[model samples]
Target: MLFIQRFVEFAHAFPEAPAIVDASSELSYGELYKQAQRLVEVIESTSSGSMIGVLMEKSVDYITSVLAIHLSGRTVVSLDRNYPVERLRQMVTSIDLSLCLLNEQEYDELNVMLDQGIRSLRIDKPTAPSADNDSVEIKPETLEEIPAYVVFTSGTTGQPKPVMVPYRSLSTLIDWMLKAPGRAGTTLLYAAQGFDVSFQEIYSALCYGDRLLVITDEQKKDMHELTREMVSAAVTRLFLPTSMLIPFVTFNLHDSQVLDDLQEVICAGEQLKINPVVRQWFKAHPQCQLINHYGPAETHVVMEHRLSSEPEDWPDLPPIGKITQASTAFLLDDHLQPVLQGNIGQLYIAGRSLALGYYGMSAQTAEKFVTHPQTYERMYNTGDICVLNEQALFEYKGRRDRQYKIRGYRVELKEIEIVVADSELVEDCLVVARQFGRTTTLVLYFTAQDRDQDLSMRLHTHLTTRLPDYMLPSFYKKISAIPLTPNGKVDLQKLPEVGGLRSLISTSYVEPHGELETTVCELAACCFGLDRLGANDNFMDVGANSITLISLLAELRYVLAYDFRQTDLFEYPTPRLLCATYQRSLDTTQQGAPTVVPASSRKQRLIAIQRFQEKKGG
Candidate 1:
């Protein structure tokens, strides 16, 4: 059955059952259906084209717009508002969207920024449908073959490639979720707007008649607030990216009750490593299951491994497990022949999980999606190296290409290099992914014709305006020349290791004064993987992301004996600004003001902070 049909059935069967919940309001099945139906009318009236662009932030209206587009028999082209306008415009032109549905704020801003030829309509309060208007009847067979949506992924040619997913591809996964026992529960829509898992969260839950909780951007960044929100909403199922697994589990170690109601945690986008903190999380919450899912955008979630054994016995890198019912995976050698078991080979996926193809890129599609000579079956070349274990489960090795998954987003190093080279700020450039423990950061090495002192800021601003934050390099190195091998190809091994705080730190080195400034510098340096930190150096300018900032916050709270918010890090980004502000607060405390840090605890914390600095600085 089509997902839309199943959604309609549930809406009729359980009118008042909660369908979607966000910070502002809750939409019951009946209300949600009415809203979607009303918007369907607006969608049909606006565009005769099958492809419609959805440019908005994650919200109730965004969800409603997606449903309405499907109901109107159109394909949704997700144009993430967080993405750079240049990137969005590229996608808009690539797909040739005739109409775009957007929030009022974005409708106004994008109308001026985007292609003016493309019609834009603001998604407002959907009104009651006309009395004479009848439901649009859609044949399941016809709908199954039609393109459900088009998602853009990073391409090697520097432009984003749009992959058209058919309804059958999604229906297969949704059907599996429906049939799976004990999986029905309230799920959280935690994935980003354009991520493939967002569809899984929205369709699987709603089609199964389970409530779907929407997490805000602010809540998603703060683990403590995210846990609290999940607990309050009674969210039983979560789709988390593997990159955040350790941090999320570690943040709730002492307060395990926040995870009590969670029955399932499906992790994807990278290899799942059962670290100490993750194993402990599972040990404390045995009732909850940890599932590692693996798939590319061309095929959404083709394999899953459920960790059923004791957490203590779990391997560091768990296998991706058996092929899902929706898809069939084959390990093939360079000659496209099937590899023997236990031998590493490139993975190729077939069956119902395969997408239609890359939109309007027939030549590129043929290059990746090939026809098997033996069986004449079509399969997508995943470009992922994997080996079959004795248990018949697939063990992920690494990528066959330069592509890397950073924070759940697929990144192509060549694309970043192309964009940088095109900017003309650099004579030549190379982009590489550098691993710092669990985090993988993009680092750009460039040689400019005449290096500017403000080159880093210029690159940041230029890249921010053309690419998404995830694609931007965390560190920029002004190299004298890019090393080349005898054959003239860039030598990967010869590239200098990104070192020293001076490369990223914009401010001149300034020694930290006072216990507070010293403590801040020490903690910042440790989290940022630097030997030392300057007092006036900005945290973000020195490559502090949300995950690192949270780690720094946790340490500061423990030593300072005061609750610090993520916002505090943003307000006082530099160590000097932060410490000076806190010192003034302490000064006010001396003048009979309420003190956030008690004098007694301040002295004790000073000793602990000094010990930490000594241990780390040593």
Candidate 2:
């Protein structure tokens, strides 16, 4: 009810103000409220429970459906439109969902997955109501008991577990956002709907009567397009996951003035480390405030640290500043006792911001949510290892569980193992994260008598259907058997190094032939720190970080005299693929005009030798 009450207030205060904007449409506060009213009537007539499923993309309709469900005193479960059919079915069956609100496009596929008794309504194809209806009347006390939304996160059992968040918790975040600096103006809702950070973008903008700009999945994947959309929309407030933010700030928007109007940029979802590239960006853009937000899905953004001025000294990782007024965090050891200051301990969160616990998993709920020994308050053990610095700020160490972040996505090693073990070619599987410089690659070690090449292809094909791209292991190694410790457990420390395994990229070598191909290949080899590079080798596998990629792109831009997007590196990872793409672009440009080489013969020789090093005889 608090969510609805705030919407009603916003509608009354700024009825004509734009509330949500997507590529195709825009909805003002008044229009949004009217749509929600109609949707609430439909939901009340069809659903009897408090939880409803919302299956739609990031658009105005999705925002309308969420508000309608909240106004109807029901919790909204956001079902991602991009989820595989099997994954979607699992989520639908996991909860006691009786009604699902979907758009016309997704209704058909999702309809087949729902039970016969469960109802599915397409918001886009809504039936006309007999008459205009008033808003649902709910007391403030009743609103306190209803959950605002439910989000699912990776579980240890290789399945996603749901965490129900109450309305008050959401309201607390909105209230804080309203008072926070640079709260006004358009905020970009760039995160996927399934992520809790997306909720911050949605509710904070609507509650404060600020414009909320939405980007499609395609735009989110292409940093160039997303930057164009942000600039075109005059976006001021931005929220991005650390993974995306790194590339955007370091490469895509490196020298662009498109985001000069940005007032506040919040980075969350993964750990925020103050690397050289990130520090350089902060120094370049001092007008905007850079905030590092830290919290789990259970407690949405309970801690915030801001970097306003250029940093004189760099730290390994940014501090997760003071806790919010709505929550309290403790550093406890394995025995649940408070650890001494500066010592690493498991983080425990307590207070109103805590979630309602895992849905339908009472045993897991009891194990994770425990009563504080001293305060007699309910607390959720965050399995993250942390320590309190001398400045009294919480500093993140690492996770205690087998879960880690891949491109800002929370991935459980067991989850990958579960999927891999389902393959017929795999006898047993052990997945681990391997770090080389700044890049982290997931490596899968398995027992298979077949050749490594055969098993790798087979496992990759099989897992592609079951898992998302980020969750896929980058390296696959076939071992006779998993190394076991004296205690008969898998010896993770003794697992084969990633370098010893076959590179996931194509192994067959392809030599560059044409002058253009040769030039591009030489530049790529320089960026990767290799003497002789093959066309089939991947830039990432050869030690190309974000910084190196940016430098490579800059060199290519000057030599080719053609603008290139940062996303090109991801789409065409190998030198062979990139050379082909560049040739195609050149062909298109030269179709109507005479061909002219951008670089002179001597200039090309100098560019090729920029980073080339001569090999010495051993």
Candidate 2 per-residue lDDT, tens place, 457-497, comes to 67977887667666777667788889999999888888766
lDDT of 1 by residue, 371-419 (tens): 8768788999999999999999999999878999988889899989888
Superposed on all Cα atoms, model 2 deviates from the true structure by an RMSD in Å of 5.1
Which regions in candidate 2 have their CA more than 4 angstroms from the true location? 180-183, 312-316, 436-439, 449-453, 499-506, 509-533, 538-562, 565-573, 580-618
- Give candidate 2's error at residue 462 in angstroms: 2.8
TM-score of every model? Answer: 0.89, 0.87
Among these predictions, the greatest TM-score belongs to: 1
RMSD of each: 4.4, 5.1
**Residue 443 in candidate 2 has what lDDT?**
78
Off by over 4 Å in 1: 125-129, 132-135, 179-184, 451-454, 499-523, 531-537, 554-562, 575-618
- Among all windows of ten consecutive residues in candidate 1, which has the lowest summed lDDT? 609-618
